[model samples]
Target: MGNCCRSPAAVAREDVKSSFSGHDNGKRDSSVAAKKAPVTVLAGVPKENIEEKYLLDRELGRGEFGVTYLCIDRGSKELLACKSISKRKLRSAIDVEDVRREVAIMRHLPMNNSIVSLREACEDDNAVHLVMELCEGGELFDRIVARGHYTERAAAAVTRTIVEVVQLCHKHGVIHRDLKPENFLFANKKENSSLKAIDFGLSIFFKPVQMRSNVVVLWPDVAAPL
Candidate 1:
């Protein structure tokens, strides 16, 4: 129970001892400690100041580990959504790996109208930022609830879009583990705005054979696994 049950003050002292252990003179190497302290969530992403490139506006949404902000590009003045995931909230190695996999999957997928495009991913000491296309319409679930129901044609259209997205993911050897209306968002507030699949936090890369075991049927009675 050395570190596991150590008090905050004891932990701080232990950290101080470890930091100066490398030096015979007992002086800590600030640069060495700084370089080794921060965790790297995304591989190959150079550390950059996110604020210099984008202005993080009002928060659009919040989840357990991160916040989605309305980000504006400083150079082109383009509107984008920035999902900033706090490093502090990444409580374990698995949490950090999940973020890395999500970013990798998004970058691996080909550009498609049915999927939200990730513009860029950057990180600093505090957080990992994912800049993606802004979908202002709203969640698909909310729209369905507000309208009470969808017309036969509208329902069919939505179904087709969702199927297409799933197909695209399977074609590229990726499986979106989480699929639901809440994860889909409309690109705009128009009546006929295109729906895009947004969240890939739970997605994973798989082999073609793995697809058979992972059955995803949008309509249980009528739909077959693709």
Candidate 2:
């Protein structure tokens, strides 16, 4: 129990030799410093906010609660993805709490390696902007459809990475209930790149004493709820 919270930009410092090595490198503080708790205010987008920091390019996708866009940092010119969720979309106080919990989990997750990293978090009068690493390599679904089939070794290697991700999430009490093939992505446009788990909107936290849920979840290769 090192630190459970931090600013969206600040993260723990754990030097590791490699990722996907399947080695127990031990754990360290990796939580965002919990703040005074400011829920994303329900309103419309203000004139100025993340727009000043990022140059929005195109719409990646949209959902009932939010819209994700491809963007570039104005200062660094770095390509990134920004998820903008409208506060007005939340139906009740519980919905707000859900968003807050999702953010907390995303921030606390060790995302520097096996997962897509959340680069920054900001909010305007209308929505909260979650800046994350852009995965231009496309979805695992696309790759699977393109390849058609894989050798036993290739399949096992991919399976091992998936297991590592689930184990990592469960170890930290977070459950990615809505896991799916479309939810995972590669960091770059390389055939040998590692996989990254993404989209934690339906994820939840559980206590060690809690019993597992029997409900079936439609993920890629494994069950979602344990």
Q: All candidates' TM-scores?
A: 0.79, 0.73
**Which residue runs of candidate 1 sit more than 4 Å off their true CA positions?**
1-36, 212-226
Off by more than 4 A, model 2: 1-48, 214-226
State in Å the error of residue 48, model 2.
6.4
- Model 2 lDDT tens row, 1-226: 2322222112111112232134435432245333223445433434346777887777776766877788788999998988877765666888877777777789888855778889977776456778899988888888888999988998897788778888999999988877667888888779888889988888888888864786655744655454
Q: Where is the poorest 10-residue window by lDDT in model 2?
A: 7-16
* Candidate 2 lDDT score relative to the true structure: 0.72
Give the best candidate by lDDT. Answer: 1
Per-residue error at 44 for model 2, in Å? 19
lDDT of 1 by residue, 1-226 (tens): 0121222223345655776776467865667555447788888889887888887877778787778888889999999999888876788999999999999999999999999999999998778989999999999999999999999999999999999999999999998877888889999999999999988988889997665664553535333455
